[model samples]
Target: MSNNNNFRLPYFLLLLILLSSSDFLPSVFAKSQNPITDSEIKKKKSECYADIDSGLWGGHCKSSSIAKENCALKCLSPACYELIYESDPLEEGEKDYIRGQEYKYCMYKLSVGESLEGVRGSFDY
Candidate 1:
């Protein structure tokens, strides 16, 4: 009887884990399916611009023209945002500046009717 109880406890725990994981996996898949839309991009850029004009700049950017410009570019392109903000931090130096310029150029190209593939080369790095 003791051995049977132990066996059942492990199985019960495994079942609980699997059940909870199954519930979580579907939501992750659903979120991944919902891609960003053009309207959403426009709305975000408008909000960023408004923040810049009001000296807020999305609460993350610095209070300066160049910083505000970069913030707007981040709003314009998700890829740019990920590259500039999401990636690992670097020591503030020439490399950082060059990478920032590259991201800015990518976002600018996208704004000027360039294909995302053309601007970014690929969606994934």
Candidate 2:
């Protein structure tokens, strides 16, 4: 009985340590706040577009409205969206619109090969 009690003591101590140290534990599930910059979005969008265009994402996505949506979904993946929006709860429609706009503007910027700092501000496309 004494040996059994001794064996349980270490397990109890370990459990206590784990629970008490929760505050100091690194948050593996914590969402990081590193927002994706325009340039990074541009790069990712370009890559996804290229993949779709080249039939890498799928042949069907190459010549349909789905192509645009595929690129938007690919570039603005769940992780990317979380990084960009970071806890901002948005309606599904708003989220879709934002994703589409981001993809559109990034593609335009890529094609133009220049900063759209003032261009985007001048008019809503």
lDDT (tens digit, per residue) of candidate 1 on 11-124: 999877876896766764543444545676668788878866776645556555556656676656667667555455333232455556556566555555444454333333
The digit string of per-residue lDDT tens for model 2 on 6-125 reads 999999998888766865454444333354567866677677777777777666556566545544554555443333333443333344555446445544554445454543223344
The TM-score that candidate 1 achieves is: 0.41
Candidate number achieving the greatest lDDT relative to the actual structure? 1
In the predicted model 1, the residue pairs found to clash are none
Q: Model-by-model lDDT, in order?
A: 0.61, 0.54
Residue pairs with backbone atoms closer than 3 Å in model 2 (clashes) = none
